[model samples]
Target: MKNIEPKIKKLTADILKDYGQGRTIDKMNAFTSPDMDVVVDILDKLQKILFPGYYRNKNYHFYTAENNLQTLIEDVLFNLTKQISMYLRYLPEYSNADYRTGMERAQEIAMEFLSRIPKIRDLVETSVQAEFDGDPAAFNKDEIIFCYPGMYAIMVFRLAHEFYDLGVPMLPRIMSEYAHGKTGIDIHPGATIGRFFFIDHGTGIVVGETTVIGDNVKVYQGVTIGALSTRGGQNLRSKKRHPTIEDNVTIYSGASILGGETVIGHDSVIGGNTFITMSVPPGSNVSIKSQELHISSKGRPDAEAKDLDQSATWFYTI
Candidate 1:
């Protein structure tokens, strides 16, 4: 190969010159920003604390739960507070405040979030039970907790929702994105999800911000409770943009329920592959019109049966 040192030097010079443009993308000063890797590490530690003994690292052995939890909780709080403080220091409102003041506020937020762990756990219990009750394949809660991507996604969502409620910036979304990357389920931390929620075979599920899901709601994979459009962009911020799902509603897989005004009313069953953009009345069963099916044996043109109706009607109550 030809000597490449000159090319490498030129490339380095070009990148350095690009950094001088002063765009946000060119920034990488960790002291001024929270590290994503550290945020993910904090998430891992939080998971270990949330589901004790399940996610314990090989380096740690739990003789008693309290001993392990004490260390784990302290570690999470310290790191969480540090990351929050780093984020707060750069905000416009905190720009004039002393660094210690930002740290104090961050500590307060972290403490408040930690205090709600029991409440979060209670909601998670309901979610696990919902999953077990909603899915025939789920043998037990342990399997759902350890093996289900949906359960893992919801666990992270519950954790991140606490921080989102606390009004801490950046970190909540970072934690949520970590879960999304791990599981193909994208649930916004800002979404208000109710108790006893279940997501079966969850992948390509998008729950947008401003979505309000009621209790006992079960959603299948490829479901999107999202906006009809985002053409308004920031003009629509803090406004209702996603659909509302009332209690006891079962939305099947590949159903796209869109628009702020769209509501899957209570006790409704939305069928698979349905596209909904309008509100449906209570106790409604919404589905696509039945399509014709054809059956034939290979090399038997005379035996072909065309336009066969779909006869199997399924119903669920959860």
Candidate 2:
């Protein structure tokens, strides 16, 4: 009994040590970190500004309309500038001088980006129209604005893409990744998506960096606009690494269109579950045939009588 008591005490000590270690590790990676929550709050405010009356449920009297929005906008700009400065300070890629210059550049870029909000709002209105027109079950534009994950993803992408264009390092990707985590739509910060774009059931969609998608393009879930391979590191870094999809193209679910040189021409329809690597001409339809499955019953005389050649039975075209 004495030996058992010591063993139990030792096990309890080990468990307690592990618990304490876990708490320490968790503290280091806590979401309550100022950087993380500040960025998240900035995004929340941006969303509220982008889609008024959809996100925040604050009671504003008639007199407070202009003042409230103006205050919120100023707050967003100030917070964003501070966050950008803070992020640049922590990132090891930039030197002290470079960080200062980059922060200045980011400030200018952010101002330009904020200036484009009116245009973005117009684009989002088109997307809302597209959603309402595309889905029969959609009740109203308000529902799409309020509840749709696709709209949220697109909004973040548009904002992040602008930052990416302005040559801000890491922040755009971080912003887009935040949206990706929430919506399951993986739109790269550097992807060039045009106005009036719509992503239907946007989960699992991958728009790679350097992908140039033109106006009025629609992409469904599980579509991968990606690169085929990166043969060399230096060559891959600055070069185009994703497919160029021209205007009025619709890529359905599970379609993987890959390679830098690959271009989907204007007015094309890519069918669901198709794998494409080469260029497609304009006004074309690409699809993959459904695969067939065979089943054989055991302990049946009729099934046994059937000639089942192993090589022939296993092979089938998709």
Candidate 3:
């Protein structure tokens, strides 16, 4: 091949020039941002703490529960403190301070978060029970805790919510996004979800930020409890954008309950594939009018099948 050293140098110089340009993509000499791998490791350790016996690492030799917990908690605490400190340095209050100051603040927040473990566990237990009671396919509570993606998603959301509540920026959203990557359920850490929340067959579910869900609420797959419109963008930040789901409500699969003002009253059953932007009264069963179906045999003539297809917009009820 012909000499390519000059071409390589030219390409490198061009790429370096792009970096030098005054755009917002450079983090050249700033303090290190939160590491995704470390955040994932924190999440894994938190899982063990949250559900004690459900997820155990075979690599670690466990002599006793107390001994194992003591070790795991220290390891997780060190890493969590470091990660939180890194993110906190970017905040306005911590911006002028040194890394040590951030670490001090992080330690305080970490300790407070750790202290809430018992309450978190209590809420998680209710979630596990919710999954067990709601899903008929669940063999036992243990099975739901171990195998359900909904439980995993909700557990991570609960943990992240604590961080969100404490106002530790970036870490909570990272934790939530990590769980979202593993499970198709996308629950925003900013959402306020109450006790005994169950998510069934939770794939393609989007629980948006500022959504308020009350106790004993169960939602199925392909549900979007989201904002009616996001046209306002940052202008709508910190404002209620999603709907309020009251206690003892069941939102079925493929349901889109949008708008902040839309309140789903208690004891309501929102049927599958239903779209609601308006407030639903208590004990209301909201469903779309069933459409007629013309089932044609596969062996039927092509012309007959084509005729059946002319009745556009097919819908399935749940």
Candidate 4:
């Protein structure tokens, strides 16, 4: 038992030495961890600011709201500045003379990002309306605002997109991934999405980087707008790699639209399980033609052997 302590310590030290090189993975490229727990808390506070009574799970009033909002804003400003400063330390392109300069820049970026909160909330309100309007199962707008995963994911994307535009690396993706964990919908922060976007049954939905989505777009579960190829890897960086979906488009469940050149024109309805590799013009409704279904039943008499469809139709993702 006494000899086991030295062996365990050496093993732990050896493992740390192996992984701490930071060459194989980008984990330790940054100077320090960017306080993701604080980031999550910041997002929660932002959610409260966005929807006061709904997220707090408590009563809302002007007196309490004023104090809380002030305190929360200040806290977010401080913590976000600290996190940004840490992130700025790692970026070679970002110029910083000293710790003071980095801190100042972080504070400036925080204030600027905070100023856009009202606008973010406004845009998200429109998204909530879109969600309510698009989903037939939705009871009310309140339900959409208060209880929908799609709304949560969209809010994260909208908030994180600002940071992405600011050229703040890592944090934006962290924010997006946080929402992804919660909702199972992965929206890259670099994706350009228009106002009034609604994601119905958001699970398994992925919107890739460079995706340009227009206003009033609705998408269902398991839909993916992704790149056709990534063989070029880092060489193809900063290129348009995803599809462009135009206005008033509804992409149904399990539909995969790939390639940067693939444009889904306005008022398009892409049906379930459809695979699109090329562009479709405006006002087109694209659906899958039913293929032959081979069904079998227990041999009661063998006369009922005609390919009778079963209760569940099999689906394949393209």
Best by lDDT: 3
Write the number of the candidate with greater lDDT, choosing between 3 and 4. 3
Tens digits of per-residue lDDT for model 4 on 241-284?
A: 99999998999999999999999877768888888887765656
Per-residue alpha-carbon lDDT of model 2 for 1-318, expressed as tens digits? 558988999999997677676554535534322376777888888888887777762655445657878877888888777666655544565436455585685577668778988877887787888777877778888888878889889888877777677666677888889999999999998988877788888899999999999988889999999999866867688789899998888899999999999998777788888788777655556666556222112222333224543223221243
Best by TM-score: 1
Q: Measured by TM-score, how close is model 3 to the native structure? A: 0.87
51-140 per-residue lDDT for model 3 (tens digits) = 787777667897899988998899888999998998887689998888688899999999999999999999999999899988888999
lDDT value for model 2? 0.76
User: Which of the two candidates, 2 or 3, achieves a greater lDDT against the reference?
Assistant: 3
Clashes of each: 0, 0, 0, 0
lDDT of each candidate versus the true structure: 0.84, 0.76, 0.86, 0.84
- Against the true structure, what is each candidate's TM-score? 0.88, 0.76, 0.87, 0.85
The candidate with the higher TM-score, 1 or 2, is 1
In candidate 4 the C-alpha lDDT for residue 61 amounts to 42
Deviation in angstroms for 274 in model 4? 0.9
Which candidate model has the greater TM-score, 2 or 3? 3
